[model samples]
Target: MATFQRHRAFPWLLLLPQLAIVAIFFFWPAFQALRRSFYVQDAFGLGERFVGLSNYVAVLTSALWQQALVNTLLFSASVALGAMSIALLLATLADRVLRGAKGYRTLLIWPYAVAPAAAGVLWLFLFDPSLGIISRALGSLGIHWNQRLNGGQAMLLVIIASVWQQMSYNFIFFLAGLQSIPASLLESAAIDGAGPWRRFWTITFPLLSPTTFFLLVMNTIYAFFETFGTIDTTTGGGPNNATTTLVYKIYQDGIVGLDLGGSSAQSVILMVLVGLLTLIQFRYVERRVQYY
Candidate 1:
């Protein structure tokens, strides 16, 4: 009995380091943010006073906060849908090619390896109004392109940059999902008079539901937090706050505006939003995920 108990506890012993890291790095900071959300503090941290829920109230009532919420939703939805759709298409095409499949996959996955900030800067250079190659090309076509001054254009540029950075990740997962699908099932569907499109709809798509659902959750979270670098480098949430997301707003409030209490409250709210969204996805969306 002692030996058996020792073996069981050994696994947990192995997990201790990881658990300690999480507690120290993630839980500790989250706890600090939560505590700070309830207190007002000076910019220099020379003084602090408990203010209860006032910070939350201020954040909820602010028009800028509401605008950031709307912008975040739009950005998240656009990035998730655009990235997943393009990745799926590319994965599907890549899977069909019999020659140079590894080479094609290598090229497809290279974008995901690029740092998000670097990717954003690259796109910004291509779209910069003053000297961008694309901007000049657009001028030649009589379409004025200035993302800095145009709210819609700024939003579009950030979304495109975010999507481009994330596409390769989705592609790798989708390609793996596609390859995992049994060939016999598709062969049987084709034998039963289903056309290529029909077989894909009936067999391929249904089998891929699991991958799609997983990517949906992951992409939503990525858009919420990981796209901060992209937005910062591309637009800085500028041009009348057209592309200001909640995370960016938190940075602006805490670092730039020096409103620590309000920023903490916003961070807490964002944490709650992420939790709720994740719960809703797992509760409703997971039911249809069709895991094999």
Candidate 2:
């Protein structure tokens, strides 16, 4: 009995530290945020009341919240789609056409190495209205590039910046997926007189389904949460809150505005949205992932 107990306890002993840390840092804070969400805050910083659901109701019913939510979803979707599609195209090209692809691979992964804030700042300079190369070029073509005045243009800039930053990660994963495919299969397809396009559609794409599934989950989560730095640095969710995302709104509310309850409610909503997406992805995509 002692020997069995010792064996059983060994794994727990190893995991105890990590479990303790998670409970302390993650769960404790989460519980606190939940509790805070039930309370109300006033402007003078002198009033805090336990209003239970009022804050949530206010936030959910607000027009600004609705607008922000839509903007967030649109921006994230565009950036993920743009980055993943470009990365897949580049990966396919590299795998099939290019000899000595190391240089191109290095260039592709460079953007992923950059910090999000830095990437945002870099993109800001690139699109700056005065004395900016891109702006000047657009001006020469009679296209006035004013991100401040046009909300659609501002959103487009944010999406482009985000996609540029994320393309490297997508590229690396797709490249790895491509490299993992067996060369013998391609050789067999060639022997059968299959054209490149035919082989790619019939064999390559089906095998790449697993990689696509993984990328979709990760990219969705990233778009939903981690694009905040880019938004904050570049747009500050600005131009009359045109670029305000859900995560950005949460930050503005909780940290900047000190509307703890409203912020927490927003957070909980965001969490629920992400959870639903993850669940759907697992349910629909897991079975479809092809393993060779």
Candidate 3:
């Protein structure tokens, strides 16, 4: 009994520092934001009056808010899908085919080591309409691609930029998951005359379900929140608010507009949406994750 208690207490003690940091930095700020959302900012932004749920109603009723919400959801879903798919394909190819696989893996993950803002800047240069390298290449083919003039192109650029940055993370996770699967199982499948695709779908994919589920949750949150840098650098939510996602809108309200109350309300909504998504994924897909 003493040993079990000591073991558990030791782990808790080790976690105390991190837990304290989270409480102070994360939970406290979130609670403050929630409290602030019920208030209104004064003319000079010095005072706040308790407006109850009016701010929430205002945000919900606003058409611009609605568009931001939809754009956020679409961006999150598309980027997560694109990142996961491309990473899975790359990891599979590296695991199966490529010579000097470790070298290739190192090279592949190198882009992720670059700072997010730097990566965004690099991609912006490549996609720049006037004097970009890729722009020149497309011009040779008489294909004009201008993200600034087109909303769809702007969204695509954002998605591609996000996917490019995140694929490394997904690739590492998936490669680890693939490598963890026992060779005996794959050998048995091969003996049963299963093709590579069939073996992967029937045997490997099921084993990888847990990793996939984890990545889906993490990547969704990341796509929604952490891609703000990329969006800020690449699009500035431009072309008539076409690329303005919820996080960017929050930034515009809180930081740029100095409307802390409205921004807090937006934050509350974002937190609720993310919480619901996480819950749904764990509740529904968790049972489907089979382990060897």
lDDT of each: 0.95, 0.87, 0.91
Tens digits of per-residue lDDT for model 3 on 1-292? 8777769778888999999999999999999999999999853767779999999999999898999988888999999999999999998888885678889899889878877788888889998999789877987899787889888888988999899999999999999999999999999999999999999999989999989999999899889899999999999998888899999999999998988889999999999988998999999988898865
Q: Estimate each model's TM-score.
A: 0.97, 0.94, 0.94
Write model 2 residue lDDT over 30-62, tens digit each, in one string: 887788788876756587889988878998899
Query: Superposing all C-alpha atoms, what RMSD in Å does each candidate have to the true structure?
Result: 1.4, 2.1, 2.1
Q: What does the lDDT come to for candidate 1? A: 0.95
Q: Of the candidates shown, which would achieve the greatest lDDT relative to the real structure?
A: 1
Ranking by TM-score: 1, 3, 2
lDDT of 3: 0.91
Model 3, poorest ten-residue lDDT window? 39-48
Better model by lDDT: candidate 2 vs candidate 3: 3
As for TM-score, the candidate ahead, 1 or 2, is: 1
lDDT of 1 by residue, 1-292 (tens): 7777769878788999999999999999999999999999999999999999999999999999999999999999999999999999999999999998999999999999999999999999999999899989999999999999999999999999999989999999999999999999988888889998988887898899999999999999999999988999999999899999999999999999998899999999999999999999999989987777
What TM-score would you give candidate 3 relative to the actual structure? Answer: 0.94
